[model samples]
Target: MKIIGIITSPRKEGNTAWIVNKILEGAKERGAETQVWYFGDLDIQPCRGCWGCHKGDRGCVIKDDMQKLNDAIDHANAIVFGSPIYMMQMSAQAKIFIDRMFARFSPRYSPYFKAENAAQKKLILAFNQGNPDSGLFQSYIDYTKHMFELLEFEVKEVPVVTGMRNGPAHEREDLRTLLKDIGSSLVGE
Candidate 1:
């Protein structure tokens, strides 16, 4: 299985990155091909809402590194989206990446609204927050998961690492072990 880990955190060595990498490590150990992409290292532009993608099969007009991400998603059996909560929501990088995903969906908003890659690829949503309480953003987390489901992804898990202001995820052995297990579970083992 091919799994792609997308890190939307600006800090390559931040808590979110650490969590994503740890999970990817478990997948790698299970012999699953894995690749990690950092948003900070890509030149992905925000969607302009031009409806150009819907006009035909041209896809997003303002092409950039997002096309690479789209191609990766099309080929991946699973995807891990990792982001750090900013202002009680996903980071700007994550938001922009999600917005660019508009090209993957049908333009119709009726019952026919369907994503092009509606193959039910497994998805794992990972988030890190400074707040000590994990439930502080449960509602938003659920919303985000639902959004991915609407995009036709079979969301498998939503792991939130709280109290990150105290320390990075790399220092939390408990979380590391838990996340690694979660990742291993993705390969159905």
Candidate 2:
């Protein structure tokens, strides 16, 4: 199985990336083909409210890096999404990436909608927050979980790491072990 990791933090070598790498490490240890994407390094344009994909086109129409990203997602059996909490929501980069998935929503509203079955695909959400308490981001977390559910991903885990402004997440042994365990569970290791 191929597992893809996406980091949406704008900061180079940011905490969210560090955590995502750790998860990928565990997946690699289990012999799963893995790929990672730093969204900050990609030119993922915001959605243009165009219904091209919904109206008989195969995929998105904005014609940027998102198409490649979507292709990777289409082939992956599992996905790990890492994003830093910004103002109690996912970072702008992550939000834009999610918004670009508007094409997947059309079968419900349009007669021209072409539905793709992305169900049963495993998904893990990792969020890094400045607040010490994870409880503060419950609503935001809930929204994320619900959104992914709507998109047909089999939500496996939502791991939130709080109070991460001082250091990289790689140095946190507890988180490292937790993420590693999550990764192993992905391939039934």
Candidate 3:
């Protein structure tokens, strides 16, 4: 099996990346091929609202690293999205990435609305917030779930680490163990 992890944080090796890597470690242990894509490192352009991809070939018109990202997502058996909440929502990077996925789906009124591979992808959605209370970010998480569902991804785990700004996540054994356990469970031991 192949698993792709997409990190949407501007900060490298930050809380977001750390959590994704920990999950990848578990998948790796199960002999799953794993890769991580840092959105900040890629030159992804915003969707232009063109319906070109919905035509014959079904490919995006904008040319950039998004082609590579799309290829990765197309082949992966599972995907993990990691991002830190910003202003009560997912980071701009994450939102842009999701928006770009418009190429993967045709208009709802169209005859070919859903892709053939739709509903075949298993997804893990993770988030890190600065607030001590993670409950405040439930709306953000729910919104993310809705977006992934629109993409036809079966969301599984949503490991959230809250109040990390007050204390480094490395010092929080509870959070560390939670991430590791979630990772192990992803591949079913």
Candidate 4:
């Protein structure tokens, strides 16, 4: 199965990114082809309120890079989304990406979702916070989980890494272990 890993941290190499790469490593070990997107590198425009995308053959009249991203998501068998926690919410980059999925809400194009059978690709969410108190991030996490469920993704359990406030935090053995399990599960699915 093809698995797409989306890293939403602006840091070139931050705690969130480190965890995502580790997951990719684990996913690769499981023989799944992988594509990783450094979200910070992209010029992802926010979804406008235009109803054009819902208007017939023309989808997402904004006409930016979102279409290609959507196509990739449609093609993938599984998805792993990793984002840094900002004010107890996902980073702006990740939020915009999720909002752009408004194009998918309408059945303008087929194959992304089989509404009849309710069959969909598996999805996993991974998040990280610098603080050890992960409790604050729960509400945002649940919202993301709900978003995926509405999108027809059969969600795998969300695994988040917290207490990583700074670098060298990757040195922690627990981070390695948790990411390893979550990443491996992505593949075995």
Candidate 5:
């Protein structure tokens, strides 16, 4: 199996990336190939809501970093998305990446999946939040979950670590263990 990890935190080597790496490490240990993409390094522009993809276009009308990212996403067997929470939601960087999925939008996605018998990919979400309050992160988590479902992917896991406003949240033992378990579960081992 192959897994593609998309890092959405602007902070390089931040807590979110640490956790996502652990999960990827676990997947690799289980003998899967993996690739990582950092959104912070890309110059992705936000969606214009043009609906160009709805008309049979396979890519975004905007010439930006999203198209390249989308190509990688299309080739991967599984996907991992990680981000830092901002205002109780994913960071602006993460939102831009999500909005870029417009390239895959259309009623044809369903028909295409059926015609090709699309592989059921394991979708994983990792989030680091500044707020320790669970309620503060629920909306973002819920939205991420919904996005995965709508994309026709099976949710393998969504593990969130909070209270990182001060330091590395993934350093906490609880969070590390949670991420490890999520990775292990994905491998069915």
Candidate 6:
């Protein structure tokens, strides 16, 4: 199995990246091929509300780095999306990446609206927040999961690391073990 970890945090060594890398490590230990992508290192731009992607097999116009991400997603059996909560919501980088995923779906009204990538891909949504209470952003987390479900991904887990203002994820052994287990579980072990 091939799993891809997408970290949208600007800090490469931040809590979000630590969580994502730990999960990838567990997946690797389970004999699954894993790759990690840092959004801060990519030049992905925000999606323009253009119908270009649905027009005749043509994908998103004005593409920069999202094309590579699209191809990676198409080939991945599972994906782990990690982001640092900003203003009680996903970071701007994560939001942009999610927006670019629109190209993967054709409009329902169009005749070409078929499940192009019908295979249900497993997904893990990981988030780190400064708030001590994990339940503080439960509603937004649920909404994010539902949105990805609508995109045809099987929402496997939503792990939120709260009270991150105190320390990074790597410093918390409990959180590290929990995320690693979640990653291993992704490979059906």
The numbered model that scores best in lDDT is 1
User: What local lDDT score does residue 41 receive in model 5, on the 0 to 100 scale?
Assistant: 84
Clashing pairs in 5: none
As a whole number from 0 to 100, the lDDT of residue 151 in candidate 5 is 65
Residue 117, candidate 3: Cα error in Å is: 3.7
lDDT of 1: 0.88
Worst lDDT run of 10 residues, candidate 1, spans: 107-116
lDDT of 2 by residue, 18-90 (tens): 8888888888888889999988789999888767877775777787998788889989999999999998899
Stretches of candidate 6 exceeding 4 Å from the true structure:
109-114
Residue clash pairs of candidate 1: none
Q: What TM-score would every model get versus the actual structure?
A: 0.95, 0.91, 0.91, 0.88, 0.85, 0.94
Residue 161 deviation, candidate 1, in Å? 0.4
lDDT per residue for candidate 4 within 23-117, as digits (tens), equals: 77777888888888887777789878777767785877776677667777877888888888888788999889877777666443343555432
TM-score of 3: 0.91
Model 3 spans > 4 angstroms off: 109-113
The lDDT-based order of candidates, best leading, equals 1, 6, 2, 3, 4, 5
Candidate 4 RMSD to the correct structure = 3.5
Total backbone collisions, model 5: 0
Candidate 5 residue lDDT tens string, 117-143: 124566898887777766776875987
**Each candidate structure's count of clashing pairs:** 0, 0, 0, 0, 0, 0
Residue by residue across 1-189, what tens digits does model 6's lDDT show? 999999999999899999999988888889999998999899998888877887877788965988888788889999999999999899999999988777787555243345577347889999989988988999999989887777777889999989988976777879768888999999864
Higher-ranked by lDDT: 2 or 3:
2
Which candidate achieves the best TM-score against the true structure?
A: 1
What order do you get sorting by TM-score, best first? Answer: 1, 6, 2, 3, 4, 5
**How accurate locally is residue 103 in candidate 3, as Cα lDDT from 0 to 100?**
78
lDDT of 3 by residue, 1-189 (tens): 888999999887788888888888878877788999997799998888777878788488999998999889889888989999899888998888877887777567243246665455888898989998969979768877876777778788888888888976667777666776676677752
Clashes of 4: 0
Worst 10 residues of 3 by lDDT: 109-118
Candidate 1 stretches greater than 4 Å from native? 108-113
Off by over 4 Å in 5: 107-119
